[model samples]
Structure formats: structure tokens, C-alpha cells
Target: MSEENTPPLPGYEGMPLAMLRHRIRSLGEEDLHRLMAYEREHAARTGVLEVLTARLDAVRQGAEPSEGDQGFQPEAAPPPAGGSPVGPASAAPASNPPPHGDPAQPARPKGDHRPGGGTRGGR
Candidate 1:
């Protein structure tokens, strides 16, 4: 199919295959059919086709799609019990080094020489 004639698949771009499969679980028959058609015409990936086919079959067997699946939730870390967040006064952090090349190399001082001559011919 031509790029210009492709249908819009809202909320699917850049989504992982597992996430896409889960996201489409709630799609009705008509919508699922549309998605299947789109997949067949464009990517035709076997794994994707299998997932869509399985979901469609499940729907046909009267399995109602569940609400959004909450995959993972991370717990927040606790702060230190009593000590202050700041480090001790005597300890100092080193300055950030310049990017690129070796850090051990000495820094180069800026010079007055200009390359390709200044705007007024190589004066």
C-alpha cells in the first residue's frame, strides 16, 4: 500500500508489541477487523497477526476485554532518618571536565590567531 493511503492507528506509533496487543484488547469486532486489515496491508508481521487473531478469537468466545492492565508500579525510596541531605563541609566535589579527547591532556589556552583570515582578507 502507498504511504499516502495508509489509515491512522491512533496511540500505536512507537508502542511495544506487547503494549500494542494489550492496548487493543478492548477493541470491538469492527475496530479489530479494521486493525487486522491495516496490519495485513502494511506490516503483515506474523507475531502481530497471531496476537490480533487470538484476541479476536477470544472476543468471539465471549471473553470480555479487561480494563487497562497495570503492569508495574515502583515504590518510592525513604530519605535518611536524621542526617541532613548535604555532605560535610570539608569534603568538596571536583569540577566537571570538558567533553571529548583525553581528560589527562592539559587544557589549551585561547590564541588571537584567526583561521581562513578575518573578514578583511588574511590580514
Candidate 2:
């Protein structure tokens, strides 16, 4: 499809399924059709198609567009300017391994060998 027929929503192609569902609620049937057509002509994703079809069906059944600006996507908002707040001071102390092998199975005594020289007792 040409640019003229692009989906009504800006950044439509990049929208995740959940975001699309929320964004499309504010759109009318005509705009939904346009988006559905664009989706079918391009990606034709099954999940997207299902969402579009379900919404269209709802619209055709007299469901009005929900309140909210389609362009106002909080989910797509950029992360905070500063990087992570975690610092060395807030980090957990490093752990050291046990000196006597794993905690689950403690190391045997120096002369605790079995008769057959096996490490496990009898069995």
C-alpha cells in the first residue's frame, strides 16, 4: 500500500499487540478498516488480524469508540533520562563458596573411605 493508505495510527507497524488493542479502542470503524487492510497487505499477522476483526465486529454491532486520544500512548513513553539508580552501595555483598565442597554433600573426613574404596557408604 502507498503512504496515502498507511494505517491511521502513527507508528502502527511498531505497536505491540496489547498497545494496538488499547489504541484501536479510540478509533472508529473506518479507521479500523484502514488499519486492518494495511495489516492484511503487509504483515497479515494472525493475532493482529484477530484483534482487528474482533474490534471491527464490535464496531459493526453498534459499539461506539471509547474515550481517549489514540495518539496518547503512555506505554510507548521513553525511559527516564538518567540511567539505573542501582549503585555499588546498594548492591548485595559477594558470596563465597563453602570450603568443604557443596553444602548439599559435605566433604568426607580424611580417612572415611569405605571397604571397596567407594566414597558413598555401602550403596
TM-scores, in order shown?
A: 0.47, 0.59
Q: Which tens-of-lDDT digit does each residue in 1-123 have in candidate 1?
A: 654434334545455687777677767676677778888876788888898899889898997866643333122245769977677775677788678778888667446545655543434
Query: With candidate 1 superimposed using the best TM-score fit, by how many Å does residue 109's alpha carbon deviate from the native?
Result: 26
Could you give the C-alpha RMSD of every candidate to the true structure, in order shown? 12.9, 5.9
Off by over 4 Å in 1: 1-9, 67-123
Model 1 TM-score (2 dp): 0.47
| lDDT by candidate, in order shown | 0.67, 0.84
Model 2 error, position 105 (Å): 31
